[model samples]
Target: MSKDPDLELVKRFKEEGSLESFRALYERYKDKVFSTAFAICGNYAEAADVSQETFFLIYRKIKRFSFKSRFSTWVYRLTVNVAVEKRRSRKEFLALSEIGEEVFEHTGDTPLETLERTERDALLNRSLRHLSPKLRTVIVLRYFQGLSYEEISSILGISMGTVKSRLFRAHRELSPLLQRPPFSAPPGGQEDAWQGN
Candidate 1:
């Protein structure tokens, strides 16, 4: 129920420089690290690279970390920043296969329904490119990860007010793109197919 274990692992690794302790940390957090990266970039290769870089940073800089912030928050900040930096100028298109069904698993009524869900997720991800990095970060943390604004602010080292403002601007910019023609549900699907932002 508590995250104190991560801190304990960090301390153990710092003191003993144990590979087992390092592996323990990576095994525990790898999914969260990878998912956050993929949720933001929407690309598997890019997300894997970001996740690798995050663990690399953790291994190298764990000693410098002050523990002023929670280890999870620090890890997220590093992962998100690195992921965003890696894909900053690249507009690589992601195929539906690259993102798993988790991104498009709302319903599986039929092949047509699955295709519709994939397209809907694809469109939403593509639209995310139009958002500034800060805005996208806020959106991913809030919508994809279901994190509270206070948690996001703590992770990103920003004010809660700034998080709200970014979300507002992001919604404003994303509204038209999201409401465009491709959003119409497939023939067998419901009227409003796309749910998550």
Candidate 2:
């Protein structure tokens, strides 16, 4: 496998405590971290807070990072944990309606298609809010974040079997709520992506 692109930068920051290296890593992952946090927390402000807290924790704990996993995987796992913690503190579950632009591609569809897609995406976002955090995380990690089963398993610290099972359950729960075809996976993602290994 190819080396993780961030490995050198991570090494620089971890070994030399280079502020520039840390900034580079931050710029690289900031959007992804914020997007993952928003998908989980649903509120932009809370997601921003989660993103901030995530990097803060990373800054303080970088020296302890075991290189057992890819650096990006570690960052994603940290982001998910922080987002989950933030969600636990809030009473209301918010919908990710604002993320439509990020979640769906702009394929230059007709005006009617655009409107329909927007409405459908809104429904899907609202439906997602009804799912428990555990189920939601799998959906966000797999479909929203476009992560593979193995990557998700690693990020969640769960077995691949458990990851597949949770995705199955999430699909079952979402089908009725959608009241249409199940939500599509991320662009370029296969329909069989969720199937058994």
Candidate 3:
């Protein structure tokens, strides 16, 4: 039977210790790995670190992989694990909206829209913090990182049904926080907004 191309590359790397085989894998998946890390980290430096270490770990550990799952799935799991570990080791884990706007800026938007988007992203990031790490991971992978259910299931080492349920619960938890009207401060010298006039 013909081997999967990625598996073939892995085989060549294992048998021949070929730099080219490994490089082929790196070139194919680096962007995906980097993007996944960046979305979780919300910072370029940390993401770069995660990407570098993830690939390094893959190089060191790929031999033990049993081929039970897709190679991409294994890569995603490794990348996410390394990124979360990096964030956990820090006293201040970088939050989502803490990211620079310039890094994510897109074309064809008015200044007003940009400001609104930035604010909304900040608010979403804040709300995300209130969730448990598991739920937060699901939300980030599903919504923020745009991964599909099957992909997320593999990445998180969970069943697809579990991924869906986690996302459901996450959205439920976030709904109250996200669905509320935009916050407005009381006028100067006025009573708190919660107080009846």
Q: Which candidate leads in TM-score?
A: 2
After superposition, which runs of candidate 1 have C-alpha atoms over 4 Å from their true positions? 1-5, 88-113, 183-197
The best-first sequence of candidates by lDDT reads 2, 1, 3
How many backbone clashes does every candidate have? 0, 0, 0
Quote the lDDT for 78 in model 1. 93
What tens-digit string does per-residue lDDT give for candidate 3 at 94-123?
655455644567679999987788777656
Report the number of backbone clashes for model 3: 0
- What TM-score would you give candidate 1 relative to the actual structure? 0.75
Cα lDDT of model 3 overall?
Answer: 0.77
**Model 2 stretches with alpha carbons more than 4 Å out:** 97-113, 180-197
Report the lDDT tens digits of candidate 2 across residue range 1-197: 45889889989999999999999999999988988898898777888899999999999999989788888889999999888877777775566656546546668799999878877776777678767889999999999879999999999999999999999999999887788444544225655422211
- Candidate 3 residue spans exceeding 4 A from truth: 1-5, 180-197
Clashing pairs in 2: none
Error of 1 at 87 (Å): 2.9
The residue-by-residue lDDT of candidate 1 on 64-106, one tens digit each, is 8887777877888899889878876675534223557653456
lDDT of 1: 0.78
